[model samples]
Target chain A: MQCPSDKSKSAMLAYVLKQYGIVIALILICTALSFCSPHFLTWPNLITVTRQISLNGILAVGVTFVLLTGGVDLSLGSLVALTGVVAASFAHPGDYPLIIPVMAGILAGMACGAANGVVITRGRVAPFIVTLGMMTIARGLALVISGGKPVSNMSPSMTRLGGDFLGLPIPVLVLCGISAVSWLFLKNVRLGRYIYAVGGNENAARAAGINVNGVKLLAYTICGAMAGLAGVILAARITTGQPNAGLAYELDAIAAAVIGGTSLSGGIGGVGGTLLGALLMGVINNGLDLLNVSSYYQQIVKGIIIVGAVWLDRKHGK
Target chain B: MIIRSSKHFIGMFLLLLSALIYSGCNRDAAPDKKTATDGSRQLVVGVSLMNLSSEFIVLINKAMLESAKDMGIKLIITDAQRSAEKQVQQIETFIGQKVDAIILNPCEVEASSPAVDTAIAAGIPIINVNSATKSTPTAFVGSSDEESGRIAMEYIVKRLSGTGNILIMQGYMGQAAQIKRDQGADEVLAKNAGIKVLARQTAEWDRAKAMSLMENWIQTFGSKVNAVYAHNDEMAMGALIALENAKLKDKIVVVGVDAIADAVQAVKAGRLDATVFQDAAGQGRTAVKLAVKIAKKEPFEKETFIPFQLVTKENVDKFAR
Candidate 1:
């Protein structure tokens, strides 16, 4: 009886650490950086850090749902470039209403997402292979459409979307809004519940009359749509449609999800955790920049932290 | 058995690589043998480019292709795709064919030297173009990257009356242009004690990344940032755009290198304060012209350096194209 009671206490500790380690990491990093750089604690610097990480945060959120369904989408980065190029093509200065380019970009993303969902479900192919193919196709299409050059000279109104409103950057606002909505959808909605079920055990889910394919399809599509929205916002931020934009962004999104305690094996994650993960990444980057760390060392540091966090997560899973 | 291990995949990759090299060598041998039998007066030149994806390289390739045709020279052009290994293989093929001349646009200084040395040992004159190589070449035709940086900094130094807090937006670290330009700009900054560096960071020669970085810098330094100096026009334009959005464009002086078409337009429109000229076409044409001379065993200089020019509103019309 004493041995079993001690085992349960340790198990509870591990569970709490697994669940809340990312939040703790974020707080610790912020506290440490505040001491390293005088600017780290300031409001403007904090907002700047948030805005810098907003792109990664939005993308991390998009990928979180798919991970919950035991799927992956490697095409988010390429889709970002594609959506940005397409939207910027239609977003000349004052020529079209702000809503037109905005809608065009989101619709393009949704259309692409739908295609990804359709193929992954109907073809019965591995989600990894399908999305990997999309990564190449989307990147090639972006380069072809943009002629291997950047589309620049966007209208003021279009660029303004990347600017601030009500003393807050638009990207930060979008990230928060999306996180709120994703939380509600993932926590309260029925389809969201089905996602967890399918991810946990697909065969069991199918036996229980759940549409496992539909849940996966839903996850992949939403992931793609969010990637596209991030893309359009990025184009607005940069004021150009760069064919080479968002290179390796999918990896970052996946890293964010993993860091937030989203198991790659699936069935466990949340947007709230992912958002914290993104902020954790952002704080490290911003703090390093503020501290004037050499860029070469910066890469090494980032790589080590990423691997260590993932390794710890895996240990918890085992 | 279920995993279908990665070892087999690697084995297949090696087999493919060996096959490619063997075929490449055979093709080179076959072409040269035919040329020898025919005894044609056609001077075959091989051009190995660093990569053909960039507009600048495309322009250079076009110039080389057209000029080779005009000179009645048969040309074999290969795109290295930014791979040093691919470039070395191309050089090996050129040596196998005993081509009259080889034009090498190296991917890097150290990685490409051995291959170019092989060409030189084969008695083929290798002309280095645009970029410098570690091994000495028969000749080089390119502009001084430092001069472009110097011109841009000179303008900023004068504009600020030799004193201001400057933010330097650098390019991809470890690249030739990035290193030389920083050296040039920093030399000037060091001379003027009144000048202070607010922050310097590598933006990796990207406009969007530069813009984002600039936005942060603006938030950090704000009014104290009296000038913005970028390593190239793209970054300069990015900084300008960010500054405009932040409503801080009026007091700051912005300068950049690379008088690309967009940068020229920006200069014309008074958005970019100044840009220094880098003559890509001139360098391309000169490289071909000198490669022909070296191949023909005619008189040619070991080093032909092109000059860099400063472009401002004062002379924007002259270099607008």
Candidate 2:
């Protein structure tokens, strides 16, 4: 017994809630944390939180592409270690120009990604199995290359990339730049639209004469390149290429993507939502630490929030 | 056409079979190759480590290798990758090979104990190095984790004149080092009531984790943090880096366990205040020597405890390289 106009109004409200629920939740959490901990809303603490999440953010953004194309990259954490070591080897003082190390890291990542793409497309293997294999292969390569020790003594100029630029942290700025370009690419580019089409329906995309394999390949390669960039930034931040660095980092990145409403199955998310998801996680961690909460409790709270966020997303989508 | 293709496939298969056999024979000849060069069957000692990826364990492995080379012993080294099950399997493989002696760097006290029993049953002398196994081995060579904890805390207490707010960056929870180090630190804390521990958290003995944890603490505690005691040099170095980033390194006293190369360098550079030296080389050397003696049917001590040393700026030069 509702009027047609009233039904449309409620439908509009539902749409807004579906799209911006995470944003509202993030705001509420931030407000609550600001009240609970005096240190939570300060400028320095905010910068620190952003800096902490930058590595995972870059990774999450990259993986979003693969996820959109109905694929997942389990090799992110290992690739981070491998590329970090490769970049650090060239990052020694007076060894190479800054750009050389950066390029080496990114190229290493891109090659691994391209390899993954080739195997998945041409070799006709599942993304999960291929990436799982790549995970171990990359880790082994990292250990062998670095001889099971942290590669340290990076040049000061390279290390400074981990520091502040103008007033903001360099890593956070990098994340912003990457997020903007990627967001635009996903929205307006023909290849970007094709990524969505392939993920949305593989048979339909093929019927429409789209190159499904090529799009999927590009998604994974982009994912790998992001991982490489993240690795270099991490090495610069820690001032070493630690063989054990980025352990379980992929899990965190995936969680951020999933929490942001990106479907594990494919074709349902964007950078805006992913950044909000990463921001929520960062704020929660910073809030817990500021409140002096025990790490054991912090872990439990984080797990619950991840599950809860995904649950809400599912409920709203349906 | 079908007959010719089948014949070609058969020839390729035969070539692959011969190649595999040749490689197998080469592997079988490795032990004898050493014997042929040595002019005698050299004493073969099998060494299994917890994890080689860790810097500390690698140091122990390096020292053992050096000592084995100097003593003309053939050491068969295997990495368990921190798996107790794998460590036991390696020990069994050594037994199958009829090794003269066995050296074990255990991954856990209880989980790695079966390795010792299996070696004992096979009538091979086994020495536990760097860590303990619940099942008694022939001999043990390790520095006391509790003593290391006590030494690090004592140095911090001295630096602070017995009164200050401190934080402790722990290793992985429930680890032997973590528990004993905590006990040792608590013992010192119980004696000095004026020194208050503001917070203690686990960083898993990882540099990156410790760095993040320290950064958070800086945000929460601000200038109230007076000192930090990390369970390992990696965590210590991490805390130092975080403190340096915040420009608070000068006001804080940072100490850690294990005088790793980086930690020693930090101490010399007047960054890290102090780090306890666990003597990886000494432990490794002694374990290998004792293992050889037991294999040769010579008397050996059942327990060998290497004392830990403290490395500060003054004494860091001695410990460095």
On TM-score, the leading prediction is 2
Residue-wise lDDT of candidate 2 within B40-81, one digit each (tens)? 768889899999988888889889999998888888889999
The list of candidate 1 runs beyond 4 A from truth reads A1-17, A94-100, A107-133, A304-318, B1-45, B65-77, B93-100
lDDT of each: 0.83, 0.89
Docking verdict class for candidate 1: acceptable
Poorly placed runs, candidate 2 (over 4 Å) = A1-15, B1-40
Task: Pull out the clashing pairs in model 2.
Answer: none
Clash pairs of candidate 1? none
Model 1 achieves a DockQ score of: 0.41
lDDT of 1 by residue, A185-249 (tens): 88788877788778778999999999988888888889988988998999998788878788889
